[model samples]
Target: MIKSMTGYGVANVENDRYIISAEIKTLNSKFLDFNLRSPRQFSDREIEIRGLVSGVLERGKVNLNIEFTAKSSTNLPVSINQELFETYFDTYKSMASRVGVNDSSDLFRLAIQAPNVVTTVSDKSDDQDEWEAVKKVVMEATQKCDEFRKDEGDTLYHKFKENLDVISKGLDEIQKEEPKRKERIKNRITNNFKDWMEENSFDENRFEQELIYYFEKLDITEEIVRLSTHLKYFDKTMSSSQSQGKKLGFISQEIGREINTIGSKANDAAIQRHVIIMKDELEKIKEQALNII
Candidate 1:
């Protein structure tokens, strides 16, 4: 079914030992994009998350953030790398001998600056558990995100349906006055011939040809039919099970084409005014399509 690109959902997990949360927010976009804010240790999961989002959301400017909390600080002790320390200490002693600042305090300071010599007592197994928790919350958040998107989609569908109805009313007005417009053009041309044909013999064949050409040019029946078809297609796509943002966008483009043709072809002042109103309604529908998926 139609789903909006704009939505927000959050999911959380709580336990005696740990709590975790994940959130997803989306905005309109031509293609899928993501801005993920998460711990560095989980950076490797970026591709997986992207695939998951693409499968469900299809298209959007999506942003996600995940955070974890522990009820108490980890009690793991500090760790020191003895081999790394020895390498750093020897290198520092050599440098100190060269510079002639051979003091124990200076050696201690230099050794402290070495990378990986002292490190946190982080557990590899603990990391796996943390990832699992993150995955769980992310799944739950996606469920909520789907529900949120559907709720927004329902509202958008109503707005678009209203716009289509307004446009249909405008079309009806234009069609009702169609006969008057055609008659006005015919009368104008006949009056002009009466005034100008007195100068020379009237060219009946040329007048007939010109009348037919202008009549065809002003006829907006085909455009109106196409516009109606496009509107119907748009409504159908919104109810489809597949993600419909791209399809909806294409239908909107077709509708715009039809509207443009009608505007150019219908030279009547009243019809033009109504077309302007239709155009405004179409603009709003196009904006709504951007947020559909």
Candidate 2:
């Protein structure tokens, strides 16, 4: 299935003690790139996060963030910065002794104000349980992210098919004019040399040779055949059950190659108009391809 490079997905996992929320957003990019943001405790799990995303998405500017919220204060991990506590305690003691005052080391207020004194580090990377909770949330979020892409991809597929039909209809119109176009070219050539025709004394043999030479040089049958073949391959690629954004891109380039050649060689105003139309439709498809995965 085709996937769009732009999408949004979010999932939240809740347990008795914690709630884990993860979100993944992306935009179009030429290569696979992933940025992950998670709780500091799970900072060591960045590699695992990357691997999780790589397994599903192949290309995009992907950003993943997971937030962990402790559901209950009791479940919140707490740690003490003993060094900071001791500093505050001794200072209070020194001032109290110098003033001949008593000190009871009531340093709860000092400890509470100290940085890192109360931290979640104990829960972030402690071991088995923390990672297990994190992994559950991440995988759930990844699944949601994949689902989002698929849903958006379906919309892209519809647009692509619509454009393909437009291109095909234009090709049909161009084909109808092909015969009339050749006749018009012949008339123009004959009119230019009318004064030198048999009635006025022209050489029939040379005229025939010139006509054949130009016909051989200006024929667009091969180009049309190749373009049609490429179009068929393009349609087939679109219908395939795999990621073919890059492949479709290459096929469209080949379509352009043939269309351009036909335009250059045909030279008639009518055929040129069709060529321009083909080009416009192809350009639309090209732009649409950038969004597909």
Candidate 3:
């Protein structure tokens, strides 16, 4: 199935002791680019979290943010920076004295509010239960992300089918014009040589051999056949239950090669117009395939 690399998913999980919120956002990338943000206490589990995300998301530029909040005061430990508080208090006291303020109560309040004056001490203890809870939240969020990718993939699938059909239709139009184009080429060549043959003696057998070789040089039959095969292969790959973004890209390149070959070799204005349309539709497919997985 086709899956888009760009998507967003979030999950919030809570219990009596903690509330955890996980948000994941992704964008198309050639390879996996994972970034994570979480509490300092969860630093030790970074590798595990990365592996979990990699397993689910596969390939993309992924940004994951985890917000962990303590629900119970007992679970959180608070600490006071006495030295920093003292420095702040003295500075505020000096400023107040210069302003002729007598109250020391305001100075204490200001000092307590200063940055790092009061902080929560991260619980570095290896708590298996908390890790399990966090893991659950992350997994749920990742699942939601995959679901989002699937939804986007469905939309892309329809879009790709539409463009492919248009290109196929254009190919059909070119096929319809092929007989007329060949007749025109033959007549034009015959007319141009009629005057020359009358003016100078030429070998009829040699002329026929050169004309056959020339026609072969201009033939696009092989290109058309190969392009049709590539199109079918692309459709089959899209239906497969695996990551095929890179494979789709490779197939598109092959399709382009055939399209270009036909455009250059066909040597007919009418067929060239159809080739242009097919090239345009193929470009659309290539652009969209970049975001597929």
Candidate 4:
């Protein structure tokens, strides 16, 4: 079945000390393009994460983000800069004495709230347990992404089928008009022959042979058969268990070629009109196929 290249998915996995969340978004592209964002602690896993996404997505522009939040107090290390705090306090005390101010009450509080005075330092240690948990979440998110693509693919499948049917119906109309088309062409050609016959005497056998050749040039039978075959093949490819975007594109091109040939060869106005409608439907199919993966 066909799969669309655009989708989104998210998953969260948590353990005692950490909660890892993964979010993935995809857009249609001719190749696999991965953009990843994660906490500095998990930077080492970027390569592995990309491999996982590329393996499943196959093709598209992928945005994968991972967020890790330490839920347990034991996992968080917050510290205050004691030396900086002391420096600020001494300066404040000196200024208060010089100004003959008796009050220095809020100096400690003000110093403690200074910029960069307090900060949390992450443990750079790569815990195997945490990495494993994050990996599982990544995989789960990717699975959900694939499911989204499959669901969108189902919608595209029906859309393509509907458009193909429209083209098929147009072909049916052309078939219905073919006999009348042939008679019109014959009458027109016969009138032309009658005018030529008045001008000069020509061999009847040669005239018959030349007329046959002209009729062959205008015959759309081969085009009709080839177009039908292409339509059938297009439908068959949708059921294949692999990516059929490129294949479907090629089939649509073939269908267009036959349609154009019929339009050029058709001498009947009704048949030409049917060919125009076929072209319109084929264009819609091509537009939808670009999003297939």
Candidate 5:
């Protein structure tokens, strides 16, 4: 089944020690473009995360964000290192005495901001279990995004089917009017030949041969055949079990070429009108196909 290139998904996973959340947003793009935001600790797995998104999404402009927070207090709060604070405070006091400044309100604030004076205790040990949980959450979010795409794809599929039907109807109208159009051309040509004969002597046999050749050139039988075949092929492509956005686009181009050729050779107002309707439907199909993947 086809999938749309636009979607949004989010998932959250939690454990006794941590809560992890992942969000992904996707937009249509010619190629896979991945942007990721996550805690620095997960930087080591950035490549793997990118690979996961690429493998699933295949192509799109994707923005992924992951956030983690402690589920329970485990001494991760920012606190002053007492020893470091005392050393900075002692230096500040000595400097204050030397500079003859008794006010120390700013000294305590400045000491607190000193390097290494404030810290967050970390369990620095690598946690494979935690990484696994985070990975599961990421995959969950990706799956949700895939589901969203599938839903959007259904809408696109219906739209494409409707337009295809309209184009097919237009082609049918053109086909139905073909005989009358050809008869008009022949009548016009015969009238022209009569005028020419009255004006100047010409070989009737030669004129007949040229007329036959001219009619053959103007005949849209082959174009109609090809156009019908293209339309059928396009319908078949849509029924396939996989995404074929680009392939369908190529087929649409071929359909357009045939329609344009017919319009050029039509020389009949009615047929030209049918061709215009076909062009309109084909344009809609082309525009919607861009969102498929």
Candidate 6:
């Protein structure tokens, strides 16, 4: 079955030390484009998270957000660099004195806001436990996202089937009109030739040869057959277990070629109408195929 590239899933998992929430949203894309937003403490695990995402989702524009909240202050992930803070405080105070500004109350605040004054602390055992919890939530969220894709895929499958049936019915109508269309073409050509022959002398043998070639050129049998085959192939590919979006896109192009050929060759208005309907359905199929995976 096919899967849609667009979906959303969120999972929250909590433990004694921390509460982790993972949200994943995906949109259609030619390749995997991953963006991550998470606490700085999890920076080390970005690559691993990306691998997990690629393994599960395969292809899409992916946005993943991980919210990590410590349950208690003791489980905090950051620490103050006291030495750096003191250095910045002294620098700010000295600069203030040089500028004849004796207000030192805000110097502590400014020092704390200085770069590198706050940093993430990596505790091996606690980090391992927290990472494990984060992984659990992320995996659960990914599973939910896959399930969402499956549901969307199911909807697309029915829509595709509906359009395919319409196109198929249109093809049948065209086929039914084929004989009458040919008869009309033959009569019209013969009548035109008669009118021309009365006006001027013409070579009979060359005229017959040209008429045969003209009829052959107007024959739409090969195009109709190829179109039918492509439709069936599309159905088969859509029913397969793996992702076939690109393959289906290629098949749609072939179908379009056949439809256009039929439209150009079909001289009858009735057949042309059917061809137009088929073209419309084909455009719908192509548009929806972009969202498939």
> Per-residue lDDT for 1-293 in model 3, tens only?
89999989999887888899999999999999999999988988899999999999999999999988887665438899999999999999999999899899988999999999999877664878888888999999999999999999999999989988998898888878888988999999999989999999999999999999999998888888899899999999998998599999999999999999999999789999999999999999999999997
lDDT of each: 0.82, 0.81, 0.91, 0.88, 0.88, 0.91
Residue-level lDDT for 172 in candidate 5: 89
Error of 6 at 102 (Å): 9.5
Query: How far out, in Å, is residue 40 in model 1?
Result: 3.6
* Rank ordering of all candidates by lDDT, starting from the highest: 3, 6, 4, 5, 1, 2
lDDT tens per residue, model 6, 235-282 = 999999897899999999999999999999886799989989999999
- Candidate with best TM-score: 5
Model 5, global lDDT: 0.88
Per model, state how many residue pairs clash: 1, 0, 0, 0, 0, 0
Report the lDDT tens digits of candidate 2 across residue range 100-172: 8674545556545767666654544666786777777777777777788888888888877787777677677
Candidate 1 ranges with C-alpha deviation above 4 Å = 73-78, 81-116, 120-129, 203-206
Q: List the candidates' TM-scores in order.
A: 0.83, 0.83, 0.85, 0.83, 0.90, 0.86
Q: Which residue pairs come into collision in candidate 3?
A: none
**Ten contiguous residues with the weakest lDDT in model 3:** 69-78
lDDT of 3 at 229: 92
lDDT, candidate 4, 1-293, per-residue tens: 99999899999976678788999999988878899999987777778888888888888889999999987664337787889888988888888889887676777778888888889787564678888888889999999999999999999999988998999999999888888888888898888779789889999999899989988998999999999999999999998998679889899999999999999998678988888888999999999888998
Residue 122's lDDT in candidate 4: 73
Residue 23's lDDT within candidate 5 is 99
lDDT of 4: 0.88
4 or 5, greater by TM-score: 5
The C-alpha RMSD of each candidate to the native structure, in angstroms, is 3.6, 3.8, 4.2, 3.4, 2.3, 3.8
Model 1, total clashes: 1
